[model samples]
Target: MSESRSGYILLGLSALLAFSYLMAGWGLPVEYPGTVALKASGILLLAVYAARRNAYLLAMALALSAIGDAMLALGPSRMTLGIASFGLAHILYAWIFLRVLRLRGMRGGMGYAMAGLLAVFGVAILIWLQPGMGELRVPATIYNGIIMVMAIIACLSKARWLAVIGALLFVASDSLIALDLFKDYDPAWRGPAVWISYVAAQFCLTLGLIRERP
Candidate 1:
């Protein structure tokens, strides 16, 4: 009925969908096309919530993320599309963090150190995955570089701790995906692990963007 009520309802539904999808992924034997929609549904709801809050950039980022989820779920044929979608989303996220940096005026040396560490980590990851990336190498490298910069700026911006945590979680999730896909590190736990980190990352980033002033 009221705005606050609707917000709560949407968040509750999103949480429910996320939990249900996680359980289904862990227990279910078969995945249909519908599963793509199911995987993206919770994040889509969060995107709607962001739009209602007038966080247009975050909303667009979330929507792109949802599209990426669907593309990835569609199988290897759509992998490029999935990477591109998520790559764009990361660019938007970096823009948001850059805005925060503008507002804050670059105060801390610690942030620079952290960002440097992240850059090093990104380079190492790229080196490891480069051998197996093949035709996708260039695009995947660009995407990896973008996300690493996003996470680094998120830290440097110092906008909100939740956003920082979300950025880190995102890095963890994507790193796992790359490792599994390119480095042949597939394990039974990879799917659920990636999903949990990704869902948590999106939820935190959404709330962080909504609540953050800078």
Candidate 2:
């Protein structure tokens, strides 16, 4: 199929997933089948689109994200496994973003500027959540580092702004997760923000790859 047609189909799937989440009341314990399915399906569709276009880096990233969602949806007890899954996903995404930066030619000051911004925010957040991080501190720190790398490389992408936006959304979603898991923050708001930002991030990343064509 044409990229345009396939992109629309993916968009429809994203809308369906979001619509289903609303119908499901958007509550906590996002382990339900419907929620998990929605969470995975949209990104999975994007993976398929990437595969069709032979964009393996983007495809692998989305596939890992879908797996991470399923692992998380298994329940609270599986949070560790979910974290590991997402950690790997972030690593893969970082690789793709870095590759893109090299291929696109670095933006000199702008590139370093974005990386600095991401690093500062990442370090600050990790410090803020350190006390409660406790046993999971190591894993959380590594994950945050990987994601920060992805976010920084994304900023180096001038034309594929969709990917940049998606990377930032991914960072935001993880931040909400950190707050929800560590700090005694607002669950009511955090819950929805997590899912929405996640789904939107995947959508943007996938569509951005489709538009970029490689």
Tell me, by lDDT, which candidate is best. Answer: 1
Candidate 1 TM-score, true structure as reference: 0.95
lDDT of 1 by residue, 142-206 (tens): 99999999999998986778888899999999999998889889899998899999999999899
Model 2, which residues run further than 4 Å from truth? Answer: 1-3, 26-31, 211-214
The residue-by-residue lDDT of candidate 2 on 68-120, one tens digit each, is: 88778768777777788788877877777767766777767776787788889
The CA-based lDDT of model 1 is what?
0.90
lDDT of each: 0.90, 0.77
Q: On a 0 to 100 scale, what is the lDDT of residue 93 in model 1?
A: 92
TM-scores vs. true structure, each candidate:
0.95, 0.87
